[model samples]
Each structure stands twice: as C-alpha cells, then as structure tokens.
Target: MNIEDIKQRITGFSNELYPFAHALIPEELQAQQLVIDGISFLFADKDCKTRLFDLLEVTEHEFVNKEFFDLKKVSIKVIYALAKKRFTQLESGLDINQFGVFYRLGLSARAALFLKYKFGFDADEVSEILSLSRIEVMTLTHESRSHMVDFIRPVQEGLQQ
Candidate 1:
C-alpha cells in the first residue's frame, strides 16, 4: 500500500493507539515520535499483512480457541499490538504517566493488558504481536484485571458509604 493509505489506516486507529503511546512513553514529543517510528517499522515489515491473512485462513488454530471472528477488528488489533511495543521501547525512565493501575505492571504485562482490553485483541493475537506465549498473555491480562478491581475498590467503597 501507498504511504497515504498506510497513514490513513494508522490514523483510523489513532484514537486507541495515541493514548496507549502517551501512557507508555511519558514525553509527548517522544511518544508521538515513537508512533511515527512504529508506523514506519510496521510498513517496513511488509509481510505483516500477509501474516495476518494467513492467521485468518487457519481452521484449526495454534492460538485462539474462539469460533467467532472478524477480520477488521483483528487487523486493527494486530497493528495496535505491534505499535504498542515500538512505542514502549521508547521509555527511558520511571517518569511514566502514573494515572492508571496499568502502570504498576511491567512493560510487557501492561502492553499485553492494553492490547487485550483497550484494543480488544484476543490473547492469542496479543501473544503473536508481543512475542509472548498465550499463557503469559493470559496471566498478564488476569493481573491487569485484578489490579483494576483493586484500584477501584476504594472508590466503590466510598460511594457505598
């Protein structure tokens, strides 16, 4: 695809990826740069789209256990997952955005959780993108959920009072 098409596709998912980038990188400029760099890297991969299509063509899969499927959603999720890693590597220090429980986890755990929950990717897809095992993704996702619940409990208790 042409650069414009690639840019357009990235922009289509900017709503989700931008916040993710911001959270991971801390500095606004570096985060934006990371996103740009990520897009470049993704386009450079060239075979990314082909790999995604190959995944779709599978009947008995090595990853996901679900029967339901959607190509558009999966495509977007795959892109987001890949970009999230690129953005994350731009982290230089602990000056991360401390606005969420996700920050409490390690980088990989946070990325896995964000891809699965915020970006709506399956555990298998997240594993493929992040290079983690399915079990690792599952564990991170569970931890993320638990952390969120723990973080919200105080607020919930106060509201009940």
Candidate 2:
C-alpha cells in the first residue's frame, strides 16, 4: 500500500494504541514512540489489534507481585494467581483520576479494560483483540474491576478526609 493508503488504514488505530501504550509505559514520549513502532508494523501485521499484542509482548516491564503499597496494602489479589507484576499507574499515586485504575492492572486486564471501556467493545470483541477466550476476557475484566475496588477504596477514603 502507498503511504496515504497506509495512513488511512491506520488512522483511528494509533489514537487507541497511544493511550494503551501510555498506560503500560509511563513516559509520554516513550509511549508515543512505542505506538509509532506499532504503526510502523502496519505493513507486516495484518491487523491493528495484532500489532497491539506484538507491542505488548515487546515492551519491557517490571514484574513485581504486589510491589506497590503505601500506608495500606492495596494488593490486586487475583494477581497473586497470575504472578503478575505490580504497577504504579499515573493516578495510582492517588492523583485522583477515576480511570487511573486501568493503569494498575496486568497487561491482559488493562488491555481488556481499555478495549471494553474505552472502545465500547464487548467481551467477544475484546477476546478476539487480546487473543483470549471469552471466559478469560470476562475473568480479566472482573479482576480489573475488583482491583479497582481494592485500590480505590483506600484512596477514596483518604480523599474524603
């Protein structure tokens, strides 16, 4: 495809990928770079969603189980089963954004939440996008919501004070 065709094909996809990359990667420039890398793969990867998965696998991540805790322990209990690394999201520092919860989740969970919540994708679509079973997508979303409740409670209570 020509440059214009490629650009037209990937138009709205970069917008989605950048935020997802930003959620996984803290640095704005780094996130943009990653999305650009993903976009560059448009010629190779047939689908935008597939490119997203490729980006997810390649990004370096800190894998810590329950590593972030301040005054109270806000553990993503389900993560223990998955041995997923803990993360400190943009608002996980209690920065007060309602959607910050997505930043704390594992890759699958975060992607699932983003696709489902941000794109209005249903479980079936998310399962296809993330390459997970329907049940797995459901479970990941459940865990994401649970993690939100688990962490947000402490921040909310503190904020109310």
lDDT tens digits, residue span 1-161, model 2? 23453345355456656666666555567567666655554445455335333443342333211111110011111221122233333334433244465555666777677768875778886776666799999999998888888876766556774
Clashes of each: 0, 1
Candidate 1, residue 23: the lDDT equals: 53
Once fitted onto the true fold, the runs of candidate 2 whose alpha carbons sit more than 4 angstroms away are 1-12, 45-101, 154-161
Q: Give candidate 2's whole-model lDDT.
A: 0.53
**Which whole-number lDDT from 0 to 100 does residue 67 have in model 1?**
21
Per-prediction CA RMSD (Å): 7.3, 14.2
Best by lDDT: 1
Clashing residue pairs for model 2: 64-85
Q: Cα miss at 57, model 1 (Å)?
A: 20
**Model 1: runs farther than 4 Å from truth?**
1-7, 10-16, 46-93, 155-161
Candidate lDDT values, in order:
0.58, 0.53
What is the Cα-based TM-score of model 1?
0.59
